[model samples]
Each structure stands twice: as structure tokens, then as C-alpha cells.
Target: MTDETRTSALQILRTLVGSPTADFHEGQYEAISSLVDGHSRALVVQRTGWGKSAVYFVATLLLRQRGGGPTVLVSPLLALMRDQISAAERAGVRAVAINSTNAHEWGDVVAALERDEVDVLLVSPERLNNPTFREQQLPALVARMGLLVVDEAHCISDWGHDFRPDYRRLRDLIAQMPSGVPVLATTATANSRVVADIAEQLGGAEVVTIRGPLARASLRLGVLRLPDSKTRLGWLLSHLGDLPGSGIIYTLTVSAAEDTARLLRDAGHAVRAYTGQTDTGEREESEGMLKRNEVKALVATSALGMGFDKPDLGFVVHLGAPSSPVAYYQQVGRAGRATENADVLLLPGTEDRDIWQYFATASMPDQARAERILSALERERPTSTPALEALVDIRRTPLELLLKVLDVDGAVRRVQGGWVATGEPWTYDAERYSRIAAERVAEQQHMIEYETTTSCRMEFLQRTLDDETAAPCGRCDNCAGAWYPTAIAADAAASAASSLDRVGVAIEPRAQWPTGADRLGLPVKGRIAAAERPLEGRALARLTDLGWGGTLRELFAPGSPDAPASAALIAACVRVLAGWGWKERPAAIVTMPSRRHPQLIESVAAGLSQAGRLPHLGSLEYLKGGPEGEPGGNSAYRLAGVWGRIGVPDALADDLAGLAATKPDSPILLIDDLVDSRWTITVASRALRQSGAAGVLPFALAVVR
Candidate 1:
């Protein structure tokens, strides 16, 4: 960056250092400026305190200044909404939060919003659900919603950091909006899956992802492996030794937060702790006092979030590892907001890992079984606690998770009277049957891959679960290490054209998994690569790839052989692969939508050959915006595919080292669909050559529109 940008960034960092938040870095401002200046929607998949709120806040200001429609910040909490409104007011923007909890003020807020008088409209999803907001004011509110800012957006994804039903309903909310009012989503932490899911849910908006650097150059990151609570408490007191400004200590449980706060206060340090379960007046008093510096440290549960913006918080001490890395990142991120040299103390207790893993790897009750259990409870009338326990294998805790899901889906209700099924009886049984077999198999396969793979641990993870499709993933653990793909000793006994002989294989003898089977532990099997009906899933996939022709029923019919042999042959291979812990389902395969290849094809082809995951990357769309973004293709896959058709080696995977050695003008070409962000391909290819490929190339269908 230029001197001006650098100077401004450091100044902001300096200004916010003593407050209690660790956001407002130079990089955050630059990223936010770039995104707002671009005037487009983006997914901010950043860690906490990377100034995510400031980004949206600044974007709102810019849009207002530019006469954009009233910026709608869809915050989840009423308190957070009010805070944003207050912040905006501090900057002199006409911000208002339409919280109708009081009922009396609801109409006034609605009328103000209808007239587009509000510059930024912050409202909870529940507020949006009201009949008044839905039927009257909501319908007309969108044309004025030039910037649809979805704050804390992950609640929408089932696989998000935190899943809430109200959040999922926002999908319908966006669908109800007036067209062309671009939606911009901001979140403190989102992984790769969350990123793709966000883009997909947001109606295919281009992802202007700003991955804030995870390193806090100024903050000292120290993880103390504590043996017990006594030692951890001692460490905390020692660290607190007269660092004047302020610090925040986080605990996983409300009781812990309270106890810690109590002990610290008793020891003569002004301390405060807050939990979601804390009483209203007491909670307010605690927060207010903490903010005023009456309390030198605030011990809090994970219940705190983006609403509070305190700069210059000197340090953040964690009692233990959080539920997820994302949580830890966001919490520590709250520290050093203004401290150029801030510190993050991560006390990953030994018990923390085991405790957290108990939740993570616990055998989840079958989704269907849980649904049925609740349905039974609902239909048969609310039974007594003992009666309910006796009727089913469930206890209160796991039941609570599913109950939460059911509650969100509006499938169940809790009344003073008892639990009752609400809304229509959603038919989960049909969907359940369609998934069970495949889900079991797929999950097993993923486990097998992870445990069996000879490749770099980071590489396997990045590719298998993380799915970083871009050519260059230099920042990942895999890109930093050597890769050694396992040479799965292909049993040469079975020739390529030989039938998958299944002679003497147990027909229904047993369902026992073999030794290595435990390793491939994903949830689904075979993706139904070739199913018996509807003919859409893995069934269509296998047929298309194997270059076979037949109806789904006929193919799966009893006694029918696949391709060149008997059903027995193919069944044998399935058994063998299963025993070896191969993915019971066919791996994710692909087909390009562009059946109409250009006679005088539009692609620039060179050095493109598919390999590694090249085959899985699917087809490249040769479009300058005719259509983009299918179920599987992202800009990364689209780029690789376009390069694939350009006569580049199809083995065009994410190995940057191999691609960098190519001569610039050689006949060898690398092609992709298009370059919305040329940096992905450019970086990928640069790394490949850096590894050792000398005959590399570049090609694509079109430049991004």
C-alpha cells in the first residue's frame, strides 16, 4: 500500500488500541474500502475482530453518501441492531432499528421505512416475520434496499458455525426482495464450506472474499497447557499484573464465568462476568460497569458478540479451547484492537480437547429416528418425563438438539400444556429413505481416505474436506509441504476391460465392515452413482462416465450385469472396494453444461491435461456471462475446466509447483472458463512452475464481464 493508506491504517489501529476490541487494523479498512468501492456484494469470511462490523458500517455510510437505497443490516439480535443504529447516529447517518417488541412504536418505524427516510434499517429476522412487516411494509421495503447487508449470516447454513432456524428462513426473505438489490453478507468467521454455501444461498453473488490475515503480528499468541483449574487461575492473576487498560477473560460455561469473576473480585481486582442466562438488570449493570473501566477485567461466556465495540482492550485470556477454532479466533480477535503490540493467551486445557470432542464425534442419533421420536411424542400427547424416557432410548440432552431443529422447522411446539406438532406434518420419511444407504457409505469413505491416505496430512484435508479448488492454494498447510499420493496397489489381476466379477460374493450373508472400512467415515455411500429410479444422482453419473446406455430400472434390475458382465462381477468389485474401505458411493464426478462445443471453439487451449482431481473438476462453461455457477462449478473449477479444453493436460489440479516451469509462448496451454479473478489461476500456475513443470500454458473462454 501507499504511504497514505499505511499511515491511515496505523492511525486507526493506534486510535482503537485501548478500548476492549481487537479490530480496526489497517488491513481491515483496506479490505472494506476495496469491497465498498467495488459496489458489489461479497462474503467476508474473516476471523472475529477483523473489523467486520466496521466494514459493513463503512459500506453503509458510503452507500448513503452515494444516494444508494436504505441499507438494510439484517442483524440477528435486537441489542446488536440498536448498537449499529447508535454507531450510525454517532457518524450522523439517518439510521433506525425497526424493533417492534414494544408494539406501539412499530407502525411509526414501518411508515418511516416505507417512505425510505431511514438510511440504514437494522431489524431482527423475527421482526421481519411479523404480519405487518411481511404483508405491508416488507414488500415495499426492498426497492429501497440498495444494500442488503446480512450480518451474522452463517445462522442460515445447517453446517454453519451456528445454526438457527430463523436464519435459514432468510433464504425466503431474500427471494421476497425486489430484484437487483445486491445482498452483501458479513460474518466474523466462516470456513470454506460456509463460504460456498453463503454464495449459493445468496443467489449466486460473486464472492469478493477478504480473508483477513490470521496472524496478529502485534499480538503475542501464547497457549498455556494448563494441568488443572488451580494452575489456570494462578496464570490469569499473574498475567493481570498491572496491565492498566483492560482485558477480557472467556469461559465456555455461564457458571464458570460467574465463578471466575467472583474469585477474581474476591482477590481484589475489579471484575465482571456476563452470560446469556444472566438477569437483565444485573447484566446491564455488569456490561455498563465493564465498559466504563470500573471493572479492570470482564469474564464472559461465549455468549458475547459483535454488538460491543471496545477499542484498546489490552489482552484476551481464554480458560480453555473453544468449541471450534473459529470460536477461539473470534474471541482472541477481540483483543489488541488498538494495541499495536497486543497479546492473545490461549489456555487450551487438556480437558478442553476431550470435552469438545465428546460433542464433535458423538454418534449423532439418526436424523430420521430423532424426527420420528419427536413426532411420536407430539402425536401421542405429551407424556410424563419417566413415561417419555421409557417409551424411547433418548435422554434430554441429545433430544434437545433435535428438538431445537424441529422447533426451528416449526415441526414441534412447547406449550404450558405440553409439546405439540405445529404446522403441516412435514414428510421427512420419504427423504430419509432416499438418504440412509448412501449417507452411511459416503461418510465411511471420507474416513477411510483420511486415515489411509499417504499424502500430506494438510493436503489431504485441504483437498478432501476443505475443497480448495483454485490452482494455487499456497497459503494452506498442504501447499507448504511435500505431497506423496498413495499408489493404491491396483490389483493387476483384474484387467481394465475385465468384468467386475462377483462370483461367490455373499448375497445377503452379512453386512460386516472389513478391517480398513472404519477409515472412510463420511455419512453417505455411493451417491447412488446409479440408482434404480428418477435417474438423476450417481446413477446418471456412472452411466455418463462409463459410456453406457440403459434405463435406471433395467440397469439395477436383479440378475442384470453391468457393461460386459454379470451382476455378480460388479457386485464382487463393490464388495472388494467396500472391504478395502473405498467410498461405497462413486466419487463426485462431473459433466459440462456446454454440450454445444464451439465448431470453431471459443477456447484458448494449452498445456491442459486433467489429473489428480482434474476429472472431478467437471466441465468448463465458455461464457462471458451467458450463465455461470452450477451446482459444482465455482470460479476455481470453471477456470480449470476452461483450461482443460484448451488442450492443457487434463490433470490440471491444484499443484502449483508443477505448473510454474512452463515457457510463456509454448504450444502447451492452460485454459479455464473465464477469469473473474485472474489472480486464482495466475497464482495457481505460478506455483506449479515453481514446483517444476516446464511445458505449462494458459487459456480461457472469456474475460469476466
Candidate 2:
């Protein structure tokens, strides 16, 4: 390249970095040169905050100055896109994004693109598959694209810690690009395997990989093996304030994040909960709040993991170990990016394994379930997700996820009517998927070793990333010997115990009946009738709640013996009742027969009846056998499993009639050991309403969310 062009690129880099003093990192210039001068595909694997953005931004400016088309950046998260847009604007690069959250602005963005006003066009990976966008906007962008930049590129590879199926569509996008259009894929978390896989996907023989050292000298990592959840909560409550600056608290589940945020807030910390359940607006606000140091921390799940740029983040504390060391490295890398000496701590829990196992298979498509769904979706008529659920035995969550995988794989097509089976033949690669699952198991074990290892934590994480330059830094608890507190104050422990012991989660009634229930011979569809629906119910706690969750999990775990409700659980249930804000109190109690935990349900019913001065009007009887519904699965299948299995027994009907005669419009409380899918309660309540009950209010020991 000519020195004049190099000087111009450096000028753009200076503007992008916001400081004339700032210069390119080790391989930043090389990557930028490759994309601009050579116009070659490059893969840059460097540490977080290593200015991956600068390389693209500078290259985009230089290329645009040379009369090239706008750079098309395929970002993974909306949050990341927002950050990139802001950074690009600061560099005087006109950038705009087209994502789910900004449909209203698409026209303006398109106009800007047509006017050649946009230097960088940011889009999510999922946007590539959008029918309207793909059919129209995307093809134009691809044809005129100057540079195709894939951020968090490891997501394209199944071997990566956080593999996203949507990212796999990038291969097609890359192939569609003009030969001379330079493509750059960047990530901080890929190991050799993931790197190789991503490079192969990018372009087998043409990809240029630029890797750098992964060690972070500013990060001081450590792990605390708390005996249990309560103790771990206590430790966090006590020491969260002691951390260096405003930062994040990572949790394994949404409930944990919420619970921890609430407890920490009650203790006078300004914190907020962030999870996949959090709305996009709130997530954006929370990210801004964290960036500006308006909140102490965002107690978040992996939803807040990638593309969140906060350079001065003080610390990152994990309530439970992440499933993979590579993932842990990515999260903890969020801290100490531009700062010196940031704290990173992990409070490993026994429950971590269970949580890990739950998520490990989240993306692994089930072969039988996939086949069933494909077979159910006739080619002639496209089937809506709900209708398909009714036709297939798969649950809604996994089923929807599987459909996306299938849609990306070309096995199915989502059209106006819904999803329809494509004529293309698809075979589930059982061996590859099984091997990936096994790799995940190994990764989980590697995380365990990360927590327990008596060596430099940073070095261990670096090694996990396959960084050749990984070596011990004179930091971390292992090297420095206990840089954090080991004790939880008595008052803090008491506060944490109180927070965790508190239980009660509102159970929302199913507003709409599962679609195609009529086709299943049940004659139910669309919105459930208000008269037949159970009132907004209450459960002692959600099965996912940090408080009472562990105990309930133990009680409901497979092979757990059915037993009477314990005094503590009964008290907790009573507390849930006391807090219940029903207009009219229940005058009678009817237990839902538990085929698995009859004694437990009976004991809870008996206790509530005795304590609340309500009549115990016998249990609802199963006519032939219990409802076919098991604990888990999609709503339609679960409803089908339990449909017509439960009925109001004669004695219960007689008692209800007599009670109605005495006190008309009296509500009857239905007790059950657990509520999952809520179909059992729905079907049972409909039966009671048909049998002349004024109102049915369902209560359960736990709600399986």
C-alpha cells in the first residue's frame, strides 16, 4: 500500500478513536490494511476492547473515500449495534441499524442508503432471514456492500461457546458478496477449533486469521466456593459494595437475577435485573444506565453478555459458574477493558451443574421432535406455531427454537400462513450433535476446573481461548492469595436469609386456549371463556425462584418420595395466602389429586383448610386414571395429556352444592402440589364451574415456569 493511503487510514483511525494520540494496536493496522488495501477476507481474534470496531470503522472510511459502497456490519445483538452506531457517529461515520426494535425508522434508513448517506449499515444476523428484508433490502446491500463485517463471529461456529444458528446464514451472505468485497470476522472468545470452523465457514482457502494474546493484566480473578445458595447470597450482599467500581452481577437464571437485584436493592444498592425476559427498551435503558454509572450493577443473565461495551466497569461477580470456561472468559472480559485492576469473582454453587445441564441442550435440536414437527407441517397448508404445537407433541419453547434451526437449514419455510415443510430433504446429524453435546459437557467440567484451579485465573481463561501466549500473571486469588473477603457478616447473612426465605409468585391464568385443540377432538380454540377460566392464582413460589426453589426442586425431583408438607413449607403457603389480594376469600378448599404426590397435596390442603377456617371438600377424583399430562412439554400436548382425565367427584360435587346453597358465590380454592402448563388447573376449574362452583382459585406449592 502507498504511504499516502496509509496516512489517510491513520487519520481516519485517529478520528474514530476520538484521540489523535491513540494509535492502532498490535494487529489492528494489519487487519485494516488487509480489508482496505488487499481487499481480502480476514478473521481477527483479539481480546475484548482491543478496538476491533476501529479496524472496521477505519477501513469503512478509507474504502468509502475511495468511492466504495457502505459497509454492511452483521452484529449479533441490538445492544451491540447501538454501541457500534454511537461509536461510528463519534468517528464522523454515518451509521444506521435495521433491527426488530426500529421498524419505524427503516424507511428513513432506506432513504439514507439510497442517498449514499450511510457509511456503515448495521444489521442483526436474524434480519438476514426476514422475508421482506431478504427479498428486497438485503440483496441490494450485499451487491453494493464495500465490507462485510461479522462481529462476535464465533457465534457462526457450533464449536463456539455461544453458537447462534442465525449466524450460520452468514455463509450464504458471504458467498453472495462480490469477490473483491473484503470481509472481516472478529471475536475475543474463540479457541483454535472455533476459529478454524469460523474461518472455514468464512472462506476455506482465502481467510486470513489474525490472533493476539488474550491475557488481561487489569483483571484480578478469583473464585469462592460457597456451601449453598443462602451463603452465596450472603457473601454477595456483604461484599458487593467493596468491589472497585460500578459493574455487573451475573446469575444463572432470570429469577436469580431478579431475586439478587431485589435483595441488593433492599440493602441500599442501586441495581436492576437484566434477562432475556426484559423488554428491549428496558434492556437498552439498563445498558445505558450501566454505561453512565447510574446504577451500581445490572444483575443479568447471559442476555447481557456480548457486545456490551463498558471500559471502566469496576467488577463482575458471578452468582453461579457459567457452563463453559470460554463463556466465563467472555463475560468477565467485560470488566477491566480500559481500566487497571478490576475485580472478577465467581461464587460457584452446587446447583450450577443442574442449571448448566438445562441450558446445554437448549440449542441442540432433538431429532425425533424435529421429524415430528416436519411431518406435521403439510406442504400444502402452512401451519402457525400454535397449530403446529397442537399437531406435534413438542413443547412451545423447544418447538419454536427447533423451527428456527429448521428454517435456517432449509428443511422448512416460514411464509404468510405460517411454517410449511419444504420439499428439501434434511437429515439430523446425530453424531455431530452428540459430539457437540459431549464437548459442552467437557466445557462444563473445564469451568469447574477454572473455579478450583490453584493458578492464575487469567492464564487459565487465556488457555481456554487457546491463546499461545498464555502465562501466569502475578494477579488473581491463586497467585496473590485471597484478595477478597471470606466471611459474610451476621446481619448481612440474616438479611439474605430473609430475602431468600420469602416466597410467593403470581400464577397468570391461560388467557388463550391452545390453537387446534378442536382438531385434537377437544373442541377448544381461541380465547378461553372468562367464565370457565380460573382466577389469577398463587403459588408458594416459582420453581425457578431463588427462595424456596432448592427445597421445592428436591421435593419434586425425579424419584423423590411423596411426603406430607413440612411445617416451613406450610407456613410459606399460608404466607402466600395471606398476601393473596382476592376480592372474596375462599370459603372452601378442594385438593387436586396428585398421582405422584397425593400425600403432599392432601397435607397442604388440610393445613390451609384448618388454618383458614375453610371446609376441606375432598379431592377432585380422576375417573379412570390420572391426566396423561406429565410435568413438562408444550401447552397443547400437556393439555392433551390431561384432557378429560380429571373430574369433580360426586362427594366433592355434593359438598360444593351444599356450600353453594348456604353461601352463594363463595369461591373454592383448588390445591395442588405443583402447577405446570396450568392445563390441569384449567381443565379442573372448568369442571368445577360446570358443577356449580361460584369461582375457582388455584393454589399450588410450586409453579413450574
Candidate 3:
């Protein structure tokens, strides 16, 4: 590199960080120089807050100064893109991003790109597959692209902790880029296998990798094995204020995140819940609040994991262990980035493995389901996801994932309207998928060992990531004795127990029939008739709740004895009814015919009937031997399977008619053991309402979340 090039890069770095004395970290300058001067692909695998972004930003400015075209950067999340845009402004570089949230600004962004006004253009990997963008904007951008940057590059490798199928599209993007265009892939968490995989994808034997030690000296790690969820909540309620500065508290599920936030706020702590379910505007607001220390913490799920940049974050506490040590390391790495010391604690629960197992297999495609989808698309026409759901029973999420995998493998193509087959012969790679599943199991076991290991926690995590610089940090709880309090105040424990003991979740009735029901030979379409709709109902609790969730999971677990509702559960059902606050009391009780848990449903209905003095009406008869489809399917398929399968029996219909004549305003309480898709409740409630009941109030023991 020439002296002038080095001098200019250093100046840009100082301006980017707003520090006159700021210089490159150990490998930052080398990575930048390789990309800018050598014009070659480079991969930087370093710990979090190690200035990985600096390499790309500096390289971008240099390439632009040499009269190169705008740099194209592929980032994973909107939060990350927002942060990078702000950093680019600090360095006097114009950065624009095109994502789902900013459809209104695409025209201006494209104009700016055409005018050669953009310095860096940030886009998500998913955007690469957009029919319009790929056909209209991508070709021009690739033709003159000066540099390409892939942030969170670990996601590209299937062996990585968080593998995303969209990232696999980057291989084709790289192959189509002009030959001299420098490419940089950066990540904070990657073991040897993932690193090699990403490097091979970038360009085997041609991609230069600059790796550094994965240890974060500023983080003090520890683990606390709590007995149960209640105690964990109590610990937080008692000691959250004791953690140094505003930080994050991670949970395994969205319900847990919201529940924890509520309990902590009731204890007078300023906190907010963040999850994938949170509105985009609210998520952005919460991110700002955490960055400015306006709130004590953001109770969040993995949705808040990547692309969030908080330099002085004080601590991170996990309510449950993540499934893998690599994932845990990435989450904890968020803390102590630019501070002298930040506390990291894990309060693992006994149910952690159960939660892990629930999510572990969700991403893998099923061979039978894949073949069914392919066969459906063989008709040579476009089929939207909802329409396709009527043809095949896969749920929306896993179906989308399968389509992306098929798209990458050349088996199918997602066009403007929907998806179409490529007529390419595709075989299920059972060997590869099974190996990946086995790796996941191994990772879960390692996470358990991490929670109980007597060795240094930081060292254990570093070694888990295959860092050669792993050693005792001498600052973790195991190394220097526990730095956090273990005792939970009696009052705090009582408060937590009370919160957990509380039950009742509102069951919002489905307002509209799913689109494409006609494709399944059902006449339903558009908005459901208001008169046929069930009144707002209640469930004892969500299957994912921290408190009642555990009990419900055990009661409804696969292979569990199909017995009557226990006394405690019956009492809980009464509590839910007591707090329902319905405008008018239910005039009678009815149960949905259940194939799996008839005893449980009947017992609950009978108990509620005896307690409330309401007559128990017979269950709705199953017309076709109960609902056909199993649990866990898309709305369209679920609704189709149960559409006409439930009918009001002759005796039940007559009794409801008589009750309606006596009390025209009262509703019939319909009970069930569990509510998954809510289609069964909808179908049954419509039958009751049509059979003379003024309204139907659906009640369930648990609602699947």
C-alpha cells in the first residue's frame, strides 16, 4: 500500500469513530488494506465490538476515492442497517438502505444510485430474491459495483449457529459480480467449521481470512442454576436494580419476554418487552430507549440479537440457556463492548432443554412435505403461500423456509405471484440433514455442560468457539467467586409466585376467513359474518407462559395419560372464569368433541358447570371422526380440515334453543382442552350460534403460542 493510501485510511477511521487518536485494531487495518489495495475477497472473524465494520467503511471510502462505483453491502437486519447508516454519516459517506420498512423511499434511493450520489448501499439478503429488484436494479448495481460487504457472514454457513437460507443466495451474487470487485465477509461468532464453510463459499483458496482471539476481556461471565421459573423471576425482581447500568434480559420465548417485562415493571422497574411480535415502530423505539439508557432494560428474545450496536452496554442476563454455546457466546458478546467491565450472567432453568428441542427441528425441511409442495407446483401456474397451504399442510413459517431452500437448490422459483417448479430433479439429502440435526443435539449438550462447568465460564465459551487463545479470564464467577447476589428476598419471591399463579389469556376470535379457502373446496371467503363469530374468549394460560405453561405442557405432553382435569387445574379454570368480566354470564356449558383429550375437556366443562350453576350441554358431535389434520399447520389447511367436521348434535341443538328462548342475551360457554389454530373453536362456535345460541364463548385449558 502507498503512504498516501494509508494516511487517507487512518484519517477516515479517526473521523468515523469521532476520535482524533483512534486507530485500527489489530486486524482491522490489514483487512481494509487487503480489500482496498489488493482488491481481493477477505473474511474477518473477530470478537464483537472489534471494529469489523471499520474495515468495510474505510475500504468503501478508499475505493470510492479512486473513482469506483458505489459499494453494495448485504446486511441481515434493519437495526444493523440503521446503525451503519449513522456511522457512515459520521465518516461523511452517504449510505442508503432498501428494505421492507422503507418502500416509500425506494424511488429516491434508486435515483440517488443512478446519479452516483450513494457511497454505500445497504440491503438485506432477502432483497436479493425480490423479483423486481433482481430484474431491474441488481443487474445495473452488479455491473459497476466497487465493493461487496456481507455482515454477519456466519449466517451463510449451514453449520453456523444461526443459518439463514436467504444468505445462501450470496454465492450467486458473488459469482455474478465483476471480477475485481473486493468482497468482505465479517462475523463475531464462527467456529472452525463455519469459518471454513464461509471461506469456501466466498472463494476457496482465494479468500484471505484474518482471525483474532474471540475472548472479550471486558466481559465477566457466570451462570446461576435456578430451581425454576418462579425463582428466576424472583431473582430478577429482587436484584435487577443491582446490575450496574441499563442492560438486556434475554428470554427463550416471546410470551416469556412479555411476561418477564410485566412482572419486573410491576416491581417498579422501568423495562419494555421486545420480540418478533412487537411492532416495527415499537422495536425501533425500544432500541433507542436502550441505547440512551432511558429504560433499565429491554426484555427481549433472539429477535434483538444481531445488528444492535450499543457501545457501553453494561450487562446481559439470560433467563434460560440458549440451545448452543456458540449462540450463547454471540448473545453475551453484546455486553462490555466498549466498557472496562460488563457483567454477564446466565440463570438456566430445568426446562431449558425442552424449549431448545422445540425450536431445534423447526428449520429442517421434511422430505414428504417438500415432495408434496413440489407436486402441487407441477401444474405450471403460480400459487400464493396461502393458496398453496390449502393444497399442502405445512405451516407458513416452515413452508417459506422450504421454498427458500428449494429456490437455492434450483428445484423451484418464486415468481411475482407465487412459486413455480423449475422441473429440476431434486432428491432429499437425508445424510446432510441428519448430520446437521446431530450437530444441533451436540450443541445443546455443550450448552448444558457450560451451565455446570467448574472451569472459567469465559474460557469455556471461547474454547467452544474453537478460539486458540482460550484461557482463564480470572474475572468470571467461577474464577473470582460469585460477584452477583444469590439470595432472593422473601417479599420478592412472594410477588413472583403471585404473578406466576395468575392465569387467563384472552382468546381473540378469528375475524376473517383465510384467503384461498375456495381452493380447498370450502365456500368461505373474506370477512366472517359478525353474527356467527364467537365472543372474545379466555384461556387458562398460554402453552409458552412461564408459570401455568409448565403445568399445561406436562398435562398435554405427548403420550401423557388421558385423564380428567386435576383438582388444581379445575380451580384454575374457575379463576379464569371469575376474572373473565363478560358482559353477561354464560347461560349454559358445552364442550368440543375431542379425539385426544375428551376426558380432560369434559372434566373442565363439568367442573365449570357445577361451580357456576350453569347446565352442562352435550358436546358438539364430530361429523367425520373428529378434525382430520394434526396440530401445527397453516390457517387455511387447519380451517379446511375442521370446517364441516363439527356439528351441533340434535339434543344439544334443542337444549340450546330452549335456553336461548329463556335467556336470549346469555352466551354458551364452549370448552376445550387446547386451542392451537383456533379453527376448531371457530367452527364449533358458528355451529352453536347458528343453532339458536345468541353467542358462543370459547374457553380452553391452554392456547398454543
- TM of each candidate vs. truth: 0.51, 0.97, 0.98
Q: Lowest-scoring 10 consecutive residues by lDDT in candidate 2?
A: 157-166
Better of 1 and 3 by TM-score: 3
Q: Per-residue lDDT tens digits of candidate 1, residues 1-705?
A: 446544544444443333334445554665555544555557765544566666665556555655777877788764566556666665556777766444677677778876768777787765565545666777677656767888877666543312344566677777877755556787765556667778777776455666543444445544445555555665565546544477788886564576667666755778887877776567667666766777788888766655555666777778865655444555666666656755555555544534354444333335655666565675546544334433344444455545545655667655444455665565454463345334434434543343334444333433433435313323322334321111212322122112212111111111121121112231222221111111111111121111111122244335654343234323332333234322222222222233333311222111112111232333333343333323122222333333322211244433322333332322122333323334334333433333333432333333321
lDDT of 1 at 486: 16
* Best model per TM-score: 3
> On a 0 to 100 scale, what is the lDDT of residue 617 in model 2?
86
Q: What's the CA error at residue 134 for candidate 2, in Å?
A: 1.1
Query: 2 or 3, which is superior by TM-score?
Result: 3
Off by over 4 Å in 3: 160-163, 378-380
Per-residue lDDT of candidate 3, residues 51-92 (tens digit): 998888899999999999999999988888999999899998
Misplaced by over 4 Å in model 1 are 1-39, 46-50, 61-68, 77-79, 98-107, 130-137, 158-163, 357-404, 407-705
